[model samples]
Target: MKFNFLAKEKNTVVNYENAVAFPLTPDYELYAAVVTTSLNASFYEKDTTRLERIKDLIQKSNPVFVAKLAVYARNEMHMRSVPLVLIVELAKIYSGDSLISKMITQVIQRADEITELLAYYQMANERNGVKKLNRLSKQIQKGLANSFNKFDEYQFAKYNRDGAVKLKDALFLVHLKAKDEAQQVLFNKIVNDALQTPYTWETELSKVGQLKYYNEAEKQKAFTQKWEELIDSNKIGYMALLRNLRNIVEANVSRYHISKVCDYLSNEKAVANSKQLPFRFLAAYRELKELNSKYVPMILDALEEAVMASAQNIKGFDVSTSVVIACDVSGSMQKNISPKSKIMLYDIGLMLGMLLQSRCKDVVSGMFGDRWKIINMPKRAILSNVNEYYKREGEVGYSTNGYLVLEDLIKRNEIVDKVMLFTDVQMWNSNMTKDSFAYSWNRYKAIAPNAKLYLFDLAGYGQTPINVEKNDVYLIAGWSDKVFDVLNALDDKNSALNYINRIEL
Candidate 1:
């Protein structure tokens, strides 16, 4: 069967060691097993062989059997497994390892209210990182606090998993740049320690994981003492909060979960006495509507901005740049170095697609590997949280004939002036595209010889060099500040127009 990331939606849920949702007397052993298995990178990267060897030893009834499969696939990509990422994300969601997952809970709670809230949180957080605004906006971010991480007592704190952070608390702290692979590894260790130290799912985290850790349970508990604080702050649902947070970061967040949002709101209303005004009536009612209204449009804006920003030096182009975004939909594109990295890229695709459409309808968005078609309308809308605008879609393809897709688009008459291909740049020729470079560009030359190519290096999987100055192929690094600056700076029309008015129009 063709791998479709969107197809996994049917199985997603919360509060589980497995597929079960929030078991009241939850199986701690199951939770323990799932947690231990996910944290061990060696278990994920090189454990497939070990798992296969122990399959007979670790029966289906054995906790380790599932562990064997999940770990081997997760780190090693032994199974070339797409499901492993899902499992890890679920583990993080239910157990609460990362703050992003926690912040995203808002959207999960109310799919509709996600847009502006997420935008505000993200903007505030980003601004928090730099000395920009004279005053920081106080948008409460317990939004992610519902899926609170549980820290072990201080004696074992360094070896514990710290609880998740609030959206504002986690702001730009999510990323850390390093001078080299060693520093990167060091950074990862410190950051990981902070995330997992006080609450080790099953084991102690490395030194690098300590960079972002703090023991402030007193403050958090004191702050979230009442449920009213959670609701008023918009931290009502785990997924809803996380979705909003992700949207802010321009990370691919899940839909608002309209059905889930309504479900929660309905249940909350059910629990209240509404003879006059229901106790939680206003909160529940408003959250549902907000989830529905804000989600899609916010997503559209975030995606559009992200895609535009992910590209380099486009803000001031005197001419409108036409973009044909050709991406890889192969099963492997779902593969990620880490959960954050993968989510960020997926978010990047949507954000950019939306941005291109608004910035210029002249832009077209599509995915290809073995073949090509635009995600064009998500192909079909799947609303969640009464407010969701779109949902992730499942599609099919498995080869990188990006060269051909590009060539075909160029061969058409009313040509685009520029083509921005957001892909990993791993195009190997088959029986057809043996001379992809010549055939593709030659055809492009026939149509719009002046056209330029801007290669968006999503995740840096591309090994081929495209000299920006020489070939007009400007490349932007994924998950870097350059991604943001280039897109924002592309064209600042305000001051530019002010300069052109020799006499006012």
Candidate 2:
């Protein structure tokens, strides 16, 4: 049997290539590190110690920069793959080839405010629309307007060359007691070094976003080119983790013209939704994975990451609360997923209990078929038994009567703090179908007025029914961590907070 997707036959390389084992060595790190320091303008100001070290790191070809940069950028963007082609191209960002410098200076700064140019390029490629691409190209190149301080930026652009100095230092060396003329010479240098490459891809990217322009023949050629670039007989897996990550990411987009940079992807939202997702690739996975069915744990983890990264103000939330979770285990649940989804869900449910336990003391979880299970124990025990619980539950059918079942729990005059119900819509009532919405609403009110209702929808496929999207239901949309982050933040908010938002006269 084959292992994972490894490059097949090896290719011949000359003496220089022999030392190189993988597609890209650690040397790529130099440029990759730029993702972080890219906007640390102070680094670019003058020949500081840090700047010199970076130059040396790049000149010698170290990989740390790229590897760390990739990891950091992924966390920040919640993205996976970046196009290898664009990564290779980033090496050109400061090629000191005056022409390339003049062309790319604008795009680099934009990386701070916008995502890298490659994401737009990817959409353009996939969509095969030239107009949108042309628009993006112009937008990128337009940033160059800020570089008019010819002498200063010219000096910055060429700062790598010898005899570089700040304006004050340069004035002394040039023997120009007059600072103005010295500045003039510096300005002239910048204008003289400007690149000749004209901005022309605005239309190209626009075409990409729309995706309908490329002819059938051209599309085939583009597909073939992309596929060819990714495979190699060499199986060193030098950057295996990184490579797998990009593969997972780029697969989100179906179109080649709309290039989702293997490393940096640009999307419209601060956070992307899994169901009714914006990007084609994410939505495709949502369908392929039947995401709504079994993505709660993943979402929770993402939420944890996001919460952890956010302002510590989160620490002040009324986390002393607790909840009881009931997850459905109907016969329909026997539906296997991605080879390991069932087991994955079991594992996730166990892990989620732990995360919840960390924040609150009262937490109980159960998997119910015709019967209900009580998973109230320490984190480790639950994890150990979750896999077995799934095995025992294999091939079982489940029934759910949301109202009667939850009502059976002991009632308190005070509302329960939280109620977490995880179920696919497999057993929602039929006779009261029209009132299902009302039933769901009443269940929340009766079971736990003060408690928050969080339904981790696990059966959403193709698309969730419009009605299911009502409040309290969160659909996990992306595989990245962001989904969980949003959920946790949402869940962590106390009902009292919302009550505070509403003040009646």
Candidate 3:
């Protein structure tokens, strides 16, 4: 009496899309969840549920793997909050040794993260009511205490803001001993709130904001001058420059300063050191485009160059390898990555899709919702190509009918070497037919046996649209440009878990 037909596949699950798919292994799921999240609620999953899911995954995963994943997410992916969350959640379950402390030291790159880690620690442990710090995780405290040695007076003063757990509270909780007489003096200043105000972009902008202006024209003049000063001083960091480009342009800064800004924007070394995701340049470009300022073209050109710099390391296919890149433009994909962010999930898809398309010598790129349509595109102008796609997204209906891509390929009897789908992975059949992505992929495999499917999981909902293990499929997650490195690794027959495992703890 064999009942094997009724049994589901060993690693399969019904996803949020209500499609039969493979669940990521504990380590894979953890990596995907950490890299793709900012701890905000997604269209398909709430922040609380995602938090619980991560906690459960961390408990299921090995402690050392979790630690390395945190470092990888922070150092490689440039993620901020979730790495701290991973460490905090890991602390609650694993109490072996200096692993947690070492992780905190590795992940906390900025002075503010010290307080952020403490705040998250307080919230995660439900210790808000009990203010005594004696029961706090000693390893975390040791890590924070050691981290104190890395900052100076300006770094500490810049982040000493009042919160549920302030910097002063963290200093007290960690019981950090001063490293030297000078360090002891700095500690006193931190405790007494006597640290000097660090010169920064915010302070500079505030000074300009306070100047009395008699009229709109006068205010614009003042702002323009201030922006020029900020640009000349080099006090504004790269991220600050990107975020305030619109303000700088609207203020009508001089051509000298604008050119200076463009130079900084396009500098390969600066862009690399910024560690910003490629979509950030796209976001900045979109904002400037809406203004229709004369400088828009200049900034757009700079952004195009900047994005290419960010994607310089992406390993794409040559002419010998035919490629098709399909981006998901479903209604769900239109949801914002964060509540206040103008950038949506689909933006990441189009950005990454265009980036891949730029590298491929022979490629077919398009968007898919209820149907898949191929759009011929040039290899250059990566950001502008993304813009073109964003403007025409409505041409396709709003539904997560991703299987239509493979079905289209099968209908055309195409022998594409690589098929890339940049999507949220909540793919389902819009018409409720028996045909699914898995079915179409299987049929296409018969004709193109060497074909590979790469799913760029932007939303990281923790499910593949198809069973990755049973097919020639690779699941890559994260909104960072480093995610492309996973593609090259996969080409070498390596999995994402293997990529994370190779990270040195």
**C-alpha lDDT values of all predictions:** 0.36, 0.35, 0.86
Go through the candidates in order and give the clash count of each: 75, 62, 0
Task: For candidate 2, write residues 1-505 as lDDT tens digits.
Answer: 2433233213211111122111212232233223212222221122233334444554455332333333333343233333222232334343332332233332232212122334434442453544332333332333233323333442254232222123232222223222477656654543455422222222222343455535876665543444334432222122231223333233332333223222122222212321111122222322333333233233223333322222121131254666666666655444432332222332333334333433445566666655456655444232333344556663334544333234434333335565555443333432334433234445656655555555444432212221222344333322222233434545433321122123221
How many backbone clashes can be found in candidate 3?
0
**1-505 per-residue lDDT for model 1 (tens digits):** 3457455433333321121111111122222222222221221133443223222222322232233333322222212222233232333223333323432342222212222233343442354533432232222223322311221123223322233322223333323245467545533444455432342211211222333435565433332232223334443443333233322222222344432333333342322211111111212222333443445454433322322232322243334666676655544344543443323233343444333443444566767656667654431121221112113333535655567666567545647776766554445444353445334655675667777666554533213222232334444433222232344433323211111121111
In terms of TM-score, which candidate is stronger, 1 or 3? 3
Cα lDDT tens digits for candidate 3, 1-505: 2467456565577877677877888888887888888788888889888888999999999899999999999999998999999999999998978999999988888999998988888777766455734577889988998888899998998888887777788889899888789999998998888999988878877987888889988888887887888899987889999999999998888888889999999999999899998788888998888896788888889988888877677875666989889999999898888887888998999998988888888789899998888887777799888888988978989888889999889888989888999998888887999988888899999999999998888887788868674567888889888888878888536687788888775
Q: Worst ten-residue run, lDDT, model 3?
A: 1-10
Cand. 2 Cα-lDDT: 0.35
Regions of model 2 farther than 4 Å from truth:
1-77, 81-320, 330-350, 369-372, 395-405, 410-415, 423-427, 430-444, 458-505
User: Which 10-residue window in model 1 sums to the lowest lDDT?
Assistant: 16-25
TM-score of each: 0.38, 0.36, 0.95
- Model 3 C-alpha lDDT versus the unseen true structure: 0.86
Candidates, ranked, lDDT: 3, 1, 2
